[model samples]
Target: MALEFSPETYKKFEETVNRYPKKEAALLPVLCLAQKEFGHLGQEAIEYVARLMEQSPARVCGVVSFYTMLNTKPIGWHHIQVCRTLPCALRGAERLTSFISKTLGIEVGQTTADGRFTLSEVECLASCGTAPMMQINDDYYENLTDEKVTEVLASLK
Candidate 1:
């Protein structure tokens, strides 16, 4: 079946488009709406967004690829993003990531077998002051230690 947005979401999409001077300029928010509606920006979602925005699929795809916040595939219930920039690295982000990987029994970029968590080593999350930190779902856990990671994961369950 062809992909589409629900009536309410379609209305929001229209509103979003109207807010922009050009339809092309609304690509980012429209893509976000599509991601929310469709779960992830798979090929169908990308094509649908392209058709709605009168953009080439390649263009839509380029935007998705450039933005780490956009997901091209489904993610686990808890998406754990570890910052790996210089600031984070110096503060033991690497160790934190390794600890998370071991605890979850999955490497970076792989979802756990039970689909509870997905681990990713990403660029700066703009919490340089926090240094070693991880963003789980939408919440940020900063100044992490092994025990803190365990405690956070436990609370999630």
Candidate 2:
């Protein structure tokens, strides 16, 4: 079957378009709604957004690829993004990431078997002063030590 937005979500799409001078300008938020509805930005979601926005799939995809918050594939409920930038790395980000991977038993970019967590190595999250920081879903975790990270992950349930 063809992909589509629910009536409530379609209303949101319309509202988003109404706020913009052009549908093109609403691409980002519309795509966000689509992602929220579908769980990830799959091919069908991309194509659907493009068709709705009167944009080519390539253009929609380009925008999707440029944003780290957008996911092209399914991820776990808790998406853990560890900073791999120089500042974080210098402050033991690499080790923190390794510890997370080991604790979750999944490599970076892999979701856990239970589908509870997905680990990713991301660029700077602009928390360089804290360093060794990570972003779990929408929240930022900073000034982490191995013990702190473990505690945070344990409390996620």
Candidate 3:
């Protein structure tokens, strides 16, 4: 189906278009807005954003695939990003990843079968002092113990 924009969305698009002198220059912001609105940029959404920006899907897809923040598929209700940098890894990120994998019964880069959680081993999140930390969606959790992580997971449901 061809994509349709609501009045409010059209207004936002207008704003974005104004932010940059050229329509092609607003592609990233448009894609980011779609991610915020739709959670992730699937093929349809990517193409829609490309059309809105007068760009090709291949160009948009290239950007999406290059950036880890731009997810191509639907994630779980809770997206967990475990820091795997030097500090976090030294503090037991491997064990923690194993623990989460066992608990969620899903490996890294995979969401739970029921689609409630996703585990991803990410690079430094700029929280080196708080080694062994993770970010759930947009919130950061630091100084994690297995018990603490388990409790947090239990509370999500």
Candidate 4:
């Protein structure tokens, strides 16, 4: 079977496309909408977006690969992304990541056995001032200590 957006989402997709001068210029946002609709940009979703955007699947895949924000595969419910840039590193992001790994019993790029969490190390998230921060799903937790991380995790649980 082929993949497609829901009626409401299709309306949103049309509006998004209309906002851009060229349909191709809407590729990124369209892909985002697809990702939200499908949960992740698997091959079928990529092809669907490509057809909708009037681009080739390879081109759509290339764009998906270029952006870390776009997920090509399924991720756990709580996507924990740790900042590993210089500022974050200086602020003990590495240690924080290790703590999270040990706490979650999962390594970087790996999801928990229960599929509750996925740990990832990413580049700057534009929170340099709040170095040593991590993004859980859509929320950011900053200025973390081991105790604070524990509290955050417990709260999530």
Instruction: Highest TM-score: give the candidate number.
Output: 4
What overall lDDT, based on C-alpha atoms, would model 2 receive against the true structure? 0.94
Model 4: per-residue lDDT, tens digit, 35-140?
8899899999999999899999999999999987788889998889999999999999999999999999999999888888989999899999988899988899
Candidate 1 matches the true fold with a TM-score of: 0.93
Q: Which ten residues in a row have the lowest lDDT in candidate 3?
A: 1-10
Residue-level error in angstroms, candidate 4, position 73: 1.2
Query: With candidate 4 superimposed using the best TM-score fit, by how many Å does residue 155's alpha carbon deviate from the native?
Result: 1.2
lDDT per residue for candidate 1 within 18-91, as digits (tens), equals 99989999999998899888878999999999999999999999999998778899989898999999999999
Better of 2 and 3 by TM-score: 2
Compose the digit string of candidate 3's lDDT tens values, residues 1-157: 5655667877888899899978888888877778877789999888888888888899999998886667888999999999998999999998999999999999999999899999898889999998999999889999999999999999996
TM-score of 4: 0.95
Listed in order, each prediction's TM-score against the native is 0.93, 0.90, 0.85, 0.95
Candidate 1: list runs displaced more than 4 Å: none
Clashes of each: 0, 0, 0, 0
lDDT of candidate 3?
0.88
Model 3 residue 35 distance off true place after TM-score fit, in angstroms: 1.4
Best candidate (score: lDDT): 2
Off by over 4 Å in 2: none
